[model samples]
Target: MKGILKKVYVIFFISYFVFFTSWFPGLSFFNNSNKVELNDNVKLQAQAPDYWPTTGWRASSPESQGVSPQKLQEMEDYIVSENIGGYIDSLLIVRNGYLVYESYPSHIYDANIRHHIFSCTKVFTSTLIGVALEEGYISGLDDYVLDYFPNRTFDNMDYRKEAITIKDLLTMTSGIAWTDQVDYYQMAFSYNWVQYVLDQPMVHQPGEVWNYNTGGSHLLSAILDRETPNGTLDYAKTRIFDPLNITEYSWNLDRQGIPIGGTLLHLTPRDMAKFGFLYLNNGTWNGTQLIPASWVAEATTSFIDVEFDQSHGSGYGYQWWIYNWLNAYTARGSNQQYIVVIPDLNLVVVSTGNTEYQFIRLLVDFILPSAGFTPLNLVFVISLIVGTISLSILLGFTFFHFKKKRTIKKLRKEFFEETDSNGETFQ
Candidate 1:
């Protein structure tokens, strides 16, 4: 009996140790005692203007403020009530250049944290294509896919495949009958993802119809890699990231070592806001032309009208999503992450969430309406205060719950050992 008890105790201890090591390698690192302090100087410095202003003023606000307080409150209420899958993490509203409103859900407020942008990477990738075209790296958007890959050959290669142009891929009319469900991650990890995508079976004529193809965007990265002086990443650094002051970010690569243009770019919420702001300002930032104004107009302009409205009430524009709201355009990712840019309204709203289809509705019904429409400043202030307090209480409960669990676990182990010892003595 004593031997059996010893074996059980040893097994339990080993299992717990292994589980703790695997699941919480540095649990103490996250404790309040070791928490890193944020620099006070880096907090948002933008001040609200004395008077509620209209659009295009650029005096009190960053560029020019638009929307009313009532509308902004409506939006916030909608997001909170929707309870979209993931926490909203962070939301920022930039009208003109000034930061109008910003919020960070209790669990996700760090400025340096980079959340996965998913399909929004396509918008950035498309922007790079515009840069490549402007710099004369390639001839034009109409350049054939075959021109970029001379050595790589395709099976059933016909005029349709040969005739397929870079523009076709950009517009998602590549004529390739490929579904995104196939172990595309594995295929992308292959030594030649571009060749694999090109070799896909042709279902229709090039540019005949639209098919949302992530692989198509990867081909853009491949083409960029072939034509640019350096690689696509280097080109992006020089043309996009560097100019925008986006230093800390990451783009995942395919098996062939090319940045996956379709998805998997990680960026801080603020940096993501910068991208939207660049588009909002017509590709100009801080008095410098980062992206060509012409490209900004062209990219956001509806290139293809998707037949069905996405759950988010958005249409597709050259990798950008067109909001149902008065011609607003956005860069959207899975789980409701959005970089919404309303050029007509001079508004940019960035939100990250894990919710399902309702996120779009939340944005349309709630967030956008609140931007500039609320009646009284006191109401907004009271609501914000209440919301903050509620969130803090919720976080406190979560922290205490975990701490109790840890203590209970320790107690259970001790109790079990004592029970085993008593049982052994009786035997």
Candidate 2:
């Protein structure tokens, strides 16, 4: 009876240890999970996608691209159940250059539908500036902003306003005393939009302060239009739109026929992913370098401490919102439009929505955590299971052997004591 109890205890202890050690990754020695450190600058080597999404994206199962489908589904469910369904038009996730997950929440929106990306256009504009700089259409960022508008006259002209440079406009440090609250509408209604932006009094010296100025962004488009041989629209079509094969899109122009630099560009969700992918690959597309790689690094790097959305980080780049905290950058627009790039994850996410609600929670809470789960290889899995089982069996046998000897010795002692009480003994 004592031997039976010892065997049961040995089996139970070994079984418990084996069950937990093999099943739970946290407790397992064979866990191969990879934690993504976003700030790591080491880029993944250039591996071509199965096919370029010039025409359309190739869809794949999320799991195939190292993403968890259940978590993605949970993300969708959270959107619907949390009453965030109506606001979002589309959400797209591209990992390892494949469209692993896409969600069009509304019947009106679809894979091919072009949604207005608002201030996401600014990032595009910033990209075009990089291209323009590379092609020599624009000399450099340090060129005086007033040099492009030599023919135009403005109000409150001073040395400070004249001192503004193209870099300042790109960085939103042009010191234009324009406020979105009143001046944005005023500029929209003004007959000469470029003139309206330029006419604003200089409140700070160029590169002196960081201000959220859409007017400064428009001024960039104006400068590009004036500097480019055929105008900014033609330059973009030839250099950017054509290279990426983004055919179905529209760019709203001001009364002067200049493309709205700060807003009003419409694009399909897939095309938006293409742009993010372009940046993710460091401005190279296909085999050709569309925008210089150096410019890509420069454009995304944070230059100023800003007071923008805290969740998105306080750093600001050239028309790009820098989230150094997350080691990601975003082309954020009004109405919650975004093209986010996480280089370390090799992921690009695009979201377009109409309501004022920011859906970054969908990325921060759901999509990001669902990626980079490095499952153990089949060999590793099999070896771990077999090894643990063998170890458990050996440990169980040893435990039972020792337990049996101890039990037998105790039984012999008890027998001797009983015999002595009865004045009898067994050999």
Candidate 3:
């Protein structure tokens, strides 16, 4: 019995260590290797025929060139105060292909930091759909879901399952009942995530009502894997990543060796900015039409009305979020990460923040107001200046406080260790 107990203890320790090690930081299991290499002499450059304006200066200017600086500052402050989630890592605002403003907060600012983009990975997944269709791997958006997955079975094994289409998944109207708030982290760790998602009971008829379902997105990934001769990641590397010049990145794969389409994509801020720029240019990069133009239009169009409270106010498109402001649409993630595109102003604003609701509120209340082209009021300008100064001070103090807390924790640990040694000696 004693020997058996020792064996069990050893097994438990090994399992725990393996699990933790697999999940540790800086040891991502995803593969993001670029499969295709371009000629060394070939140089790709951004081709913007005309440059956007960047004029006007005031202490609290309502607008600068096209977007308001005061409003941008206000949004920044709100994000810091709310303590959103990860970090307000990077922000870049571009107008007519010219960079207007860019910022990287001190806490999460690093050239090589690849932030996890949660469900924002859906946007990339959707883009792959467009690529597959354009490349003739997919017949059309109307192609039935079961056409690819002939062997798979659903809860309602009927013709209704046949009604599920690529478009249905993109629109989030697949009629599949799914809970987004559930602990998906545990589900991701399971050995059969694809089977688990597919086996979910159908709650309604296909395309009856709009429902936000991440599982549907995974189905799309499965479809891509089936249709393409090469693996999904390899296809993305050749078709998307190679063309965009993205070398460093990672994408999570499920137990079935399929990319987890709904979430967990890690990318550097600069590479993320490239994606934003690609969409802003209407699927064109460096004058090359990488994705079909019609697909971009269709993808950004509102397919379902989303309930946006203080946290978020946007309609859902093909894995994209369409905002009511200035006919803007964005690829957004939890905790305020966004790549907002406004076609009218020819502007693209990319902001990564930790604060959830406060960041959205700031964008609506402060950023939008300041984006107007009109002149500013004197009192408003002074207030904006004061607010900027105060917010800077607050950020400084917050960082200092966090540092002090870490110091105290280290000291306490040392003191406790000393006390434990003394107690052992007394015993």
Candidate 4:
């Protein structure tokens, strides 16, 4: 009986571990931390107009900000029905520079966990290049790419490769022979990324063709590595991330110590929205100009026309994706990670997910219509999500807590009773 009780205790602890670690039924008890908060979101929008969100995002309701709560609910429902929210870590919607909607699915993932944004890191590298220009680490985009690598010897050096400019790499028109399908993994495995990229033979003349070259992005990383004041990651901390108050983040490095520029940037969903907000505000945060407005314009504009996905996007900008939609851009990553900016709407929608679905179209379908179609009446309604957890969730947790305790108490009584009944206990 003593051994049996010990086994049962071990099982109880194991049950605790399993329930808290993964998303299982009733994990909401462990996941929910925020107490119920109720208020009108619109009344607080401009309480401090100069706010930069350096601390954290201020929560709001969609309806208070002229967004239809019902439609937002529809979008959330679609995400659940399609298993979209389950695939992603977080989904956030910001309108008029206010965070109106946010949802995190898995119990493990919360607002604080910094996620690997994957290819979305490409645009950040580009943004850093702009900072490099501002800080005078780089002279201009028209400068030769080879000039940044004077000491590194290239056996395959030629006029076409030498003609490659900072601009060339920015637009993926470096024309360097790179098949991202195969070369990306190869480059990640190799010890010397710069050499591997510089070694690739020039298949087309510089700025002649738009090829999806991951090598080109790695080259930008190498360039920043050499040219910037500190390493690229350190420079990012001071110039981009810190300025935006993105204090919690991790930039993964290659085996060679090169920070993966094309991908490998990690940020929380709210921090990612700050980046979009940075671009949306034309690189200004609060009153300071963090990135040049000119760079923001050039970086988001269609620099080249490349067809993709059978439907969206007219071309690629410096590191951003310029879609066919008016004044719209996105920083996209593999597995459907997106930080989408709609300049026309003054809106930013962010998601970090695993599935490859058009979250933007879903936005257009569900969220966008609610923003403009509804008339703005100043009446405030009680928010459905004002409480962090619903009454059912609360009751469920209470029931489960008491039930576990009662079961454990019953087990203890029964075990001792059975042991006493045996009359073989000498202790």
Candidate 3: the clashing residue pairs are 84-354, 84-355, 85-354
Show the lowest summed lDDT stretch of 10 residues, model 3: 30-39
User: Alpha carbon lDDT of residue 423, candidate 4?
Assistant: 87
lDDT measured at residue 294 in model 1 versus the true structure, 0 to 100: 78
For model 3, how does the per-residue alpha-carbon lDDT over 240-285 read when each residue is reduced to its tens digit?
Answer: 7888777778998888889988887877666676677677666776
* Model 3, position 426: C-alpha lDDT score: 30
lDDT preference between candidates 3 and 4, better one: 4
- Model 4 — which ten-residue stretch has the worst lDDT? 374-383
Q: Deviation in angstroms for 28 in model 3?
A: 51
Alpha carbon lDDT of residue 69, candidate 1? 61
lDDT-sorted candidate list, best first: 2, 4, 1, 3
Better of 1 and 2 by TM-score: 2
On lDDT, the leading prediction is 2
Question: lDDT by residue for model 4 over 1-427, one digit each (tens)?
Answer: 4454455445545544543333331332332221121132110121223456777787778877667888888887887798766676788888777789888864447898888898899999999999899889999999998898887788587889889999999999998888888999888777787788888888899988999887899789888988887789999898888878898899888766768889888899899999988887778788888998878888887888976544556788898888643346888898778998766556688988766776666666786676652111111111122222243445555577788899999998898889889985645
lDDT of 1 by residue, 88-128 (tens): 77777776555777777546556678888888889999999
RMSD in Å for all candidates: 21.1, 11.6, 23.6, 21.5
lDDT of 4: 0.75
TM-score of 1: 0.69
Query: What is the Cα-based lDDT of residue 120 in candidate 1?
Result: 83
Candidate 4: C-alpha RMSD to true structure equals 21.5
How big is the RMSD of model 1? 21.1
Candidate closest to the true structure, highest TM-score:
2
For each candidate, what TM-score against the reference? 0.69, 0.77, 0.68, 0.74
- lDDT (Cα atoms) of all candidates against the true structure: 0.68, 0.82, 0.67, 0.75
Model 2 per-residue lDDT tens digits across residues 164-266: 9989999999988877878888988999889899888999989989988989899899988988989888888888899999998999999999998999999
